[model samples]
Target: MARTSIDYEDVYQALPGMVALLTPDLVFADVNEAYVRGTGRPRESLIGRYVFDVFPESVNAPDAKNSHHLRASLLRVLATGERDTMPLQRYDIESPEHSGDWQEHYWSPVNCPVLGPDGRIRLILHRVEEVTEFVRARGLGGDTAGRVLEAELYTRARELQELNTRLREAHAREREVALVLQKAMLPATRQMGHRRAAVRYRPAVGALNVCGDWYDLVDLVGGHRIGVSVGDVVGHGLEAAGVMGQLRSALSATSRVADGPGQALNVLGRYANVVDGAESATVVTTFIDFDRHVITYSSAGHPPPVLLHRDGRVEFLDRATDPPLDARPEPRPRPEASVAFSPGATLVLYTDGLIERRREDIDVGLRRLADSLSHHRELDPEPLADTVLRELLPPGGATDDTALVVVRL
Candidate 1:
C-alpha cells in the first residue's frame, strides 16, 4: 500500500476552468494556468497587479459597461461575503501582439468570497467562462435561423439585466422612504433627569434597512419620572414598519396619560386589535420613578428586562409577563409588576432579537445576556449597550431587528 503526495498548487494550476485569486482590495494574488492562457497574459506580469489596471476598459467602446459590471460584482462579494453571478458581458481585451488593439470577448463571470478562520472575507475568487466563440458564431449570416435565435437570446439577457437594475433602484428608493418614515416615527431619547440612558436600533441585515423593531424614551408628566419601551412587530419590511409606527405612537401617547405601564400597554393591546399587521406583536414598557425609587413594568409577550445592581447582581423582571398584543379573543387588563432599585442600578430593555438564536434554547441566550451584563456591570450606559450587542449578536449580525435601551438609575 502506498500513499500519494498531493500538490494543491499543481491541482489549482491544472484546473479546467479559468480561475484567479484576488485580495479583498481587488489586487490579483494568483491565477491558474487556464486563466493565464485564456487572458493571453504572462503569470509574472498579471500577478500582484490591480485587476482593472491590467485589463483596462476598451477606450473605443464608450457604451460598454464591462468594467463597471465586473467591479460591481467583485465589490458585492466583498460587502456581502456571498457569491455574485454577473450577466454575460462583452469585455474587449488588448491584443497580445498588437499594441493598442482590442479583441471583443464575451464571458460569463462569477465572483465569490473566501472567508478566513475568524469568519471575515480574506480573498475573492474570480472565475470566468469565455463565450466569445458562441457569441460570434451567432452573428454569422450563413446560418440565418441560428443567428436569429441567438440574437433573440442575447437581447433577452440584456433586457433581463436592465430589468434587474431597475428593480434594484426601485428597492433602494423604497428603502430610503421606509427609513425616513421610521426615523420620523421613533422619537429621540430625552434627558432622564439625573439618570443616564442610551438607545440603539439595528434593522435586519438584508431587509432593506427597515424593520418592525422600535425603542422609545419618554419624559413623563412629572419631571422625576421617565418611561422606556421596546417592541417588535411580527413581520419585517415596509408593512411591518408601518404597523410598528402605529403601535409605537399609540403606546407613547397612552404612556403619558395612562396610570402606569400596565394601563398603557392595555390601551395599546386594544388598539393593536384594530391595527393591520399588528397581531401577535410583543412589547415591554417600564416607567422609572426616580422620586419614589420604584420601577413599574408591563409586558405583552416580550422578553423580560434585565436589572443589574451596582453590586453585580442580575435580576430578570419577569413578573408581569403576558400574551402578545391582540392574542386573546376578548380584551383584558394587562398584568403589571413593580420592583424597587437602589441608586446606580442599571435597567436594560430590549427586543427579542437581542437574545434569541436559531435552534438554541432561549434560556441559554438569557443566561448569556445575564453573564455579560454582570461581567460588564461597571461600564456606563452607552458602553454597556455596545458591549452587550457585541457579546450577544452573531459576528455576521442578527437576522432579526434589535432595539435596546439601557438606563442608569
Candidate 2:
C-alpha cells in the first residue's frame, strides 16, 4: 500500500470538536480553533502551558469533583495506551476577560495517545464535545419527541430522560446536604434570654447551590441583654456559605465583648474583609435590654427590622444605615438607634430574600411586608413569621434563601 503526505494540521484544526495536541509531558503542543473557542482562552496562553495549570479545579466548591475526575482521566490516558472517555463533566473556567471570575462549562471528553514512528506514545490527543445545551434541552423538553424514528428516538429520549432524572436527584441530594449543613451552623431554637423568640430559614426552591443567609440568637452580658442578628453574604454556593458561617461565629464572639450594636458591627466589618472571598455582607443586629426596656440596633446595609406595636401600628427601624460589611477597608463607626418597646410589641429581622421579588421593585415588597405585618400583628411571633413568609413567597416560592428572626417583648 502507498501513502500520500497531507496537511494533517489543516484537517485537525478544521474539526468541529475541540481538539488539543499535548506533549508526552502533558504540555499543550497545539490547540485547534475549536479548542481555543471552547476554552475561551487564546492559543498563546495555552500552547506552552501545562494542561492542569491552564485549567485548575475550583478549590472552593461546586466544581472541585469535576476537576479531580478530569485530571484522573487524563493521567490514566497518559499511563495506559487506551482512549479514556469521560462522562459529562463540569469544568468551570476562569476567564481573564471577565476579571478572573469562574464561568460554568460542561463537556463530554475523550483522551487518546498518539504514537510516534517507533510506536512509542509521543503525543496525547484531547477531544471535548460540549453537551451543556443538549442536557439543558433534555431537561426542558415535553413528553413528545416531535417527528423522528420511534424506536431509536425512544431509546435516545429515554436516555435523556434518565440523565435529566439523575441530575434532578443529584441536585436534590446536594440541596438536602447544604440545608443540613446550614441548619447545623445555626442555633436550634435556643432562648435569647427572657424574650420570646422564633427563627425560620428557607433555602431557595430547587436550588442546588448553598447561599449565605443566616440568623442567630445569642445571650449578651450574662443574660442581661439578648443579641439577635440576621446576615447575608453577597453570593451563592459553598464559598458564600462558608463566609456566612464565619461571619456568624465572629458576630457571636464580637457581640459578647462589645457594649452595643455600633461597636460590634464596626469590628465585624473588619473581620469580614479578612475572610477570603467575603466581598460584602448585609447584617441587622439588635440588642434587647430587658432591664432597661429599650432595644438598640444597627444595620450594615441590611434591610431595616420591622416593629409591630402593641396597638397595631407598624414602623421600620430605618436608621444607622451603613455600607455592607467588607465594603470598606477603613473602619467607619456604625451608629446605633434605640426604641422602647411595649410589653406586647413584636420585632422582625429578615434577609432581603424574604420580601424581594424578581420583577418588582424592592420598595413594593417592603410595602407588602409592612401591610402583612399590620394585618398579622395579633398573631404569635412564630405564626407571624410564618404568615409573612407565606404571603411573600406563596406556593411557587422564592429564588434566594430567606432567613428570619422574630422576637416578642
Candidate 3:
C-alpha cells in the first residue's frame, strides 16, 4: 500500500519537532511550521526549494564538518541506512518562543523512505530535535567528577585519622604491658663494675607495634665471666615478646650451672623446648662469656656479634649454628666459637632488626654500622650502641624491632 500524502498544510502544523521530507539529492519536497520557526525563515522561502540553498547553515564541503556535522550525518544516513544524534549547532535551530539567545540543542536525525504510489522508496524523512536548554543547564562532566573526587578524599582522610588515633592508643597500651612484663622476667638492672650496660626499647613502626627482642647480663660469682645474651623468640608483637620473656627467665636460671658458651646455649635450648610443660620450637640465642682477655660465644642461628676492635677493625664472630632449639622433637646440637678480644674492643650482639630495613636493603645499613664502628674507635660501648641505634636504623620506630648487647673487652 502507498502512503498517500495527507493535506500537506495540516500535517506540517501537526509536527512537534522540525520535520521535512527531502528528495534523494537534498531538495526540500515539504516542510513543517516547526522547521520554519527553528530556521527563522518564512515557510514560502523553504517549500519546494533545495534544502542546502534555503538553510546554508546545514551545508558543508564533503571533506569538512559543517557547524554541527549536520550535513555529514544526513549523508551517512543516506549512504548507510542509519540514524545519528547531534548536539547543538547547525543541525538544530532554536525556537522563537524562548528568550535566551544562547541555545543548548540536540538533533536526533531519522531518515525514513516514504513510498510513492508505485510502492518503493521515493522521499526521505529528516527529523531535527532542539534540546538546547537541556545541554546548557547542567554542569560540565569534568567539574562534576572533581567534586565527587574531593568528597571521596575527604572521606579517606577522616578514616585514616581515626585509624591513627586507635592505633596510637592500642600501641601505647601494648608497649606498656610488654615493657613491664619483659623487665620483670629478668634480674633487676645491676651494673657490674667490669661492665656498663645501655639498653633502649621502642615499639615497632606502623600500627601493630609489637616486638619480641630481649637481652640480659648476669654477674657470676667467681668473677669468671659476664653472662650476656641476645635472643629473639618468633614474631613482631606481644606473643613474641611473651615467648621472649619465658626464654629469658629460663636462661637466667640455667646459665648459673653451665660453665662454657656451648653448655650455656645447650641448656637454654633444652629449657625453651620444654618450658611451661609444652615442647615447642627453639628460639635462636647467643650466649657470651666475657672474661677480660677473650670472649667465648655460642649461637643457635643468631647473627654473629660484631666486634669493634680498638684499632678500628670490625669482625662478626660466631660459631656454626644448628637450627633453633624447638624446631623438632629433638634439638640440634649447639656449637660455640671463641675470639680473643682486641684490647678495648666493643662487641655488638644484635637481632636482625639492627641491620634489616624495608625493601631488604640491609647491606647498605650493615656498611653504615660497620663504618660507624670503625670511624669511632674510642667511644665506649654504651654511647656507641646508642649512636648506632639512633643513626643507622631507620628513623622513628623500626619496621622490625632491634635489640643490642654491647660488651667491652
Candidate 4:
C-alpha cells in the first residue's frame, strides 16, 4: 500500500482570510490569495522582498519612510517567541499606476511566532483582518471595536476629503469642455436676406453632461429662400454633441440642393443610418420663401414650431410627421405644410427642453408653451424669446441643453 503526502502549500493558499508566513528576518516566505488581493500586490513581487521595502509610505516622494510600527511588532514576536496583537494601523500604500498617490488602508493584524523543534523562533504566522469598510461606514473609527481605531480613522477621513476635491475639479473641467463644444455648434445671429433671425442657447445648470441641441440657418442660391433648422439628439455628453454637429452640417448641405424641409429631413434619415450609436433624433426644418411671402416647414418626430400671427392668433405648424431618424426603415415621404407669413408675425423654433417637464405629459408642456407665447405675442423678437423661456421654465431653468431661434417677419 502507498500513501500520498499532503500538499501543505496548497492548504496554506486555500485559507479564506489574509494569511502569510514571514522568515525570522521578516521577509515574506509565503502568502495566500486573500493576502495578495488585499495588498493589491502580486505574490511573485512580494516573495523574497523585505516587508518595509515593498510597502513604503511613498515611493515617488523625496522623503521615503518605512513602517516603524510594523517593524516593531515583528521584532517583538521574534524576540518573545509569542503571539502579538497589533493595534489598528494606517498603512498607506503608494499606487504606482496612480502616480504614487497614497491609498489609505486600515487593518487589524496579528503575528504568531512559529518555533522550531530546537525551541527557537523560525517563522512568524502573520494574519491581517481588513477593517477599512467598517471604519468608513461608521464615519469614524472611534465607535468601531471599542474606539481602538479612532486615531487611524482620522487619516482615512482626510483621504476621503482629498478624493472628493479631486472629483469636483474633474467635474469643473468637464463642464468647461462641454460649454466650448456647444458654443462651436451654434453660430451668431444673422439676417437671411430680408428676414431677421436671432438665436439663444442655454446649457443645463446642474447637469454634469452636455446635450446635443442645435439651430442652423442656410441661405439658398437665389437669395429668395432660406433654410432654418432646429434639432435635438437624444442623450447627453460628448457623443451627443458630436452627433449634433454632424447632423447640423448634413442638414445645411442637404438644404442647398433639396427642395424643402420634407426633402432635407429625408436626406438626414439616410445619414443617421451610418452614424454609430446615433439611433434617433427629432428635427423641425423650415424654408422661408420671401418671394411668395410663405414659409414651408416639416417635422420629423419633433415638437411643432409655434407661429404667432399679427392678430394675436397662435397656431402650431404641425403636419403628418415622419418618425425620428432611424426610427423606421423605409418610412413614408415627410409631409410639408405651408403657411403665409403675415406682416409683423413671429415664428418660434425650439427644442423640447423649452417645454418638456419631468413628471407632466408632453401635451401639457406644449399647451403651456402656446399659452406663454400668446401672452407675450406683442414683444419684440429678442424679448419674445427671453419671455417664453422665463415663463415656461422654472426659476433655475431647464436641466437639459436648450436652443431657441426666433424669426420676426
Candidate 5:
C-alpha cells in the first residue's frame, strides 16, 4: 500500500455541508463553498463581516427571530465551551438575484467551540443543514387535514425546544454557583518578594470548571521563608471542591505554626480524618528558606517536586514520601526531607494531572515531566510554568484538575 498526505484545508473547503468558522466574538473568519452557495453570498464578502450583519433578519418578517435564536446558540457555546445543537429555525436570507427581496429558509444548526492549547475557546464552528425544501413539502399537500397535522408537529417541536432551553439555563445557573464557591475558596497568588513565582489552576474539561485540585502560596513569619503546596482531593464537583478548600485551609494554618513540613502534614492528616470526602487525598508541601538556601519538603503520596538546575540537570525531591491522608488507621508522624539549591535553580510543584495519563505507567509520566523541565530550565518561573503546562497537558485538556506552582531560587 502507498501512503498519502492529507491537506485538511482542501478537505474543509470541499466538504458538502454548509460550514463557517467565526471568532469567539462572532465575526466571520472563514466559510466553505457550500456555505457561500447556501447563503447566496460571495466568500470574500462573508469572511470579514459579523455573522448577524451579513445575514440580518428580514424586515418583512419582523417576528421570525432569525438572528436572535442563532446568536443565543453561539453565545451558549462560548460560555460553556460545549457544542450546542439548535432546533429547526426559520431564517430568511437576502435573495442574490433580487436585492430587495428575502427568501424564506429553514435550517438545522449546531455551534461548537474550538479550544486552544490552554483550554480556552479560540474560535466557533457554525454548521447548518438547510431544510427549507423539506419544511415546505410538509405544507404542500392540498388536503387540509395533512397541513394541519404538520402544523401541530411543528408546534410540538418548538415547545420541546423551549423546554430544553429552560433546562440548559438551569444547569448554567448551578455551574455558576459552584464556580463562585470554588473561586472564593482559592486565594489569588500574591507577590513572592525577592523570589519570583507563578501559579496556575486548570479544571477538567467538561467538568463544569469545578474539581478537587488546589494550590496555595503563603508568606511565612520571616521575610526569607515561604510555604507552597499543591493537593488533589478524591472526587469532583461541589463535594470535592468543598473538601479541597477545607484541607487546603487546614494545611495552610498548620504550616504557619508547625515546626516543619512533616508536622504540618501530620496535623492536616488528622483534620482530614474527620472531614468527609477527604480520605485518600494526596498533597505535597515545601517550605523554602531563601536565607538558608534550603527547601524542606514532605509528600502525602503525591508526585515529588522537581528541581531544575541552570545546567539542564533535573532532581526529583522524593526522599520523604508517605501514604495519602487518612490512609493509615492509626495516626503517625509523617516524614520530611530537605535539599539545598543554588541560585537560579527552579522549583516546580503540581498535581497528578500534570503528568498522569490514562492506562500508562506513572514512571513514564514522571520522566516526561523531568524531560520538559530539563529542556526549559533556562526560562524564568512565569514562562517556565506556562511552557511546562503547554508541553505536559493533553491536546484536548486534562480530564482531571491540575494545579501548578513554580518558584525560582
Candidate 6:
C-alpha cells in the first residue's frame, strides 16, 4: 500500500484527545498521533491489531477499568439509540511525564454506522476523555476546608447541651437538700394562751432558705413576760442558719434569767463573744421584753427598730445597744434604753436584709424603710412584709440576708 491519501490524518492530528477509527472487524483503521503518544505505541504496530488485542487487560479488569468498559457503554447507547455520559473511570498508562502516577479518564463513544450498500450497520466511532480533575472536584472551592470544621462544631455543641442538662439536675437536688435542713430548725410554740408567734421564714430572692435571719419568742417570768429576739447570723446558707440557731437558743435561755430587756441583751452579747469567739464577726440585734404593755428593748450594731404610731407616723428608733453579740466579751458600760408602748401602735424590728440595699448606704435604706412603713400603714404584717420584700431586695437577691418582726401593740 503506497501512500494512501487518507485526508482524515489532518483532521485527526488537530483533535485534542486520543482518537481512533476502527474497521468492521474492530481492527484499527486510522488513529491520531495523540493515540500513539498516549499508548506509547507505533502506528504500524497498532494498525492491524484487533481492538481487544491492543488492550488485553480491559477484559480481565471488569470493574478494574480499561477502554473496553467505555466501548461497552457506547454499545449500550447504540442499542438504546441515545446519547450517554459515562462516570469517571481510570486507566494505568506509563507516561514519561507522570512516571507511575495513575491516569484517571472518561470516554464517550458514538456510533456512526456506515450503510454498506445493503442497508446494514458497519463501522463505529469512538471518543476518549481524561476526567481526573472533574472527579476530584465534588465540592471543590475555597470553602472546602470550612465544611469539615463546621461538622466538628455541630458535634461539640450537642455535647455541651448534654452536659448542661446534667448540671441543671444536680443543682436542683442541692436546693432540695438545703430546704430540708432549714425546716427542721424552727422553734416550737414559745408563747401563751390563744395568741401565739410562729416564724414565717421567707427566702432571699434567689435562695431557698439559706439565710442568717431568724427569730425566737420564749415565754419567761412565769408567762407574765415574753422574751422576743430577732437577729441576723452574718452569712447565708447552712453555715449562717446553723450559727443563728445557736445564738437564738442562747438568747432565749439568757432572757429567762435576766431582769429586763436591756439586761438580757447585755448578758447575751457577752456570751455570744465567748461562743462564736472574737475571730468570727456577728451583726447587731434588738431584744424586747413584753411585761404586759411595758415594752422595753435593747439594740446592737444592727439596723434600728421602726415604730409605726397609730396616727400613721413611722420612726426609726436607732437606740444604741451593746456592740454586736460576738464583737467582744466586755459588757457595754453604757445603759440600754426603754420605751413605754403607745397603745394601739405597732413596732417593727428587722435585720439588714429588710432595710439594707446593695448600692445605697444603711442610713438611706433606713429612711426608705421608715418611709415605706408610714406609706403602707393600713397593711397587715404579712402583706406589708411582702411589699417590703419586693421593694427592698433587688430582683435577684439581697447583698445580705434579712429578718423582720412586727408587733401591733
What is the RMSD of candidate 3?
25.8
The true-structure Cα RMSD of candidate 2 reads: 19.8
Q: Give the higher-lDDT candidate: 2 or 6.
A: 2
Q: What does candidate 6's lDDT look like per residue over 1-409, in tens digits?
A: 0011345457768787777776656778777887787666789988878887776653323556546666675566446645444433445455546766544333333345443434444545555554435435654322342344345446876998899999789768867877776666655433344333333455665565656777766667654566556776655666666776677777778778776666776666666666542223333333444445555666655566777887888866657555566555456643456666665566777776666554456689888887887887777665776676667666656545566666555
- Error in Å for residue 189 of model 4: 1.6
Error of 1 at 76 (Å): 16
For 169-207, candidate 5 gives per-residue lDDT tens digits of: 987987998889878887775677777888888888777
lDDT of 4: 0.79
Question: How do the predictions measure up, each by TM-score?
Answer: 0.66, 0.60, 0.55, 0.62, 0.62, 0.54
lDDT of 2 by residue, 312-349 (tens): 89889987778888777688889999998888899899
Measured by TM-score, how close is model 4 to the native structure? 0.62
Once model 4 is optimally superposed onto the true structure by TM-score, how far is the C-alpha of residue 25 displaced, in angstroms?
A: 63
Clashes of 5: 0
Q: For residue 303, what is the lDDT in candidate 6?
A: 64
Task: Give the lowest summed-lDDT range of ten residues in model 1.
Answer: 140-149
Better of 2 and 3 by TM-score: 2
Off by over 4 Å in 3: 1-175, 185-190, 207-210, 274-292, 361-364
Q: Rate the local accuracy (lDDT) of all candidates.
A: 0.86, 0.80, 0.63, 0.79, 0.86, 0.60
Q: What digit string (tens of lDDT, one per residue) describes model 3 on residues 1-409? A: 0012246568667888988888868788888889777667677777788776665552222332343365666676667655444333323344456744433243434556564535444677878765444434554233343344446556876999999999889888987886677567544445667666665554456523345667778755455566777776556566766677778777776777677667777777777766642233333333444545677667666666787888888987745555555555665557776677754677777776777654456577677778988887677767877887887666545656677766666
- lDDT for model 3, on a 0 to 1 scale? 0.63
Question: Mind sharing the TM-score for model 5?
Answer: 0.62
Model 5 misplaced regions, further than 4 Å: 1-167
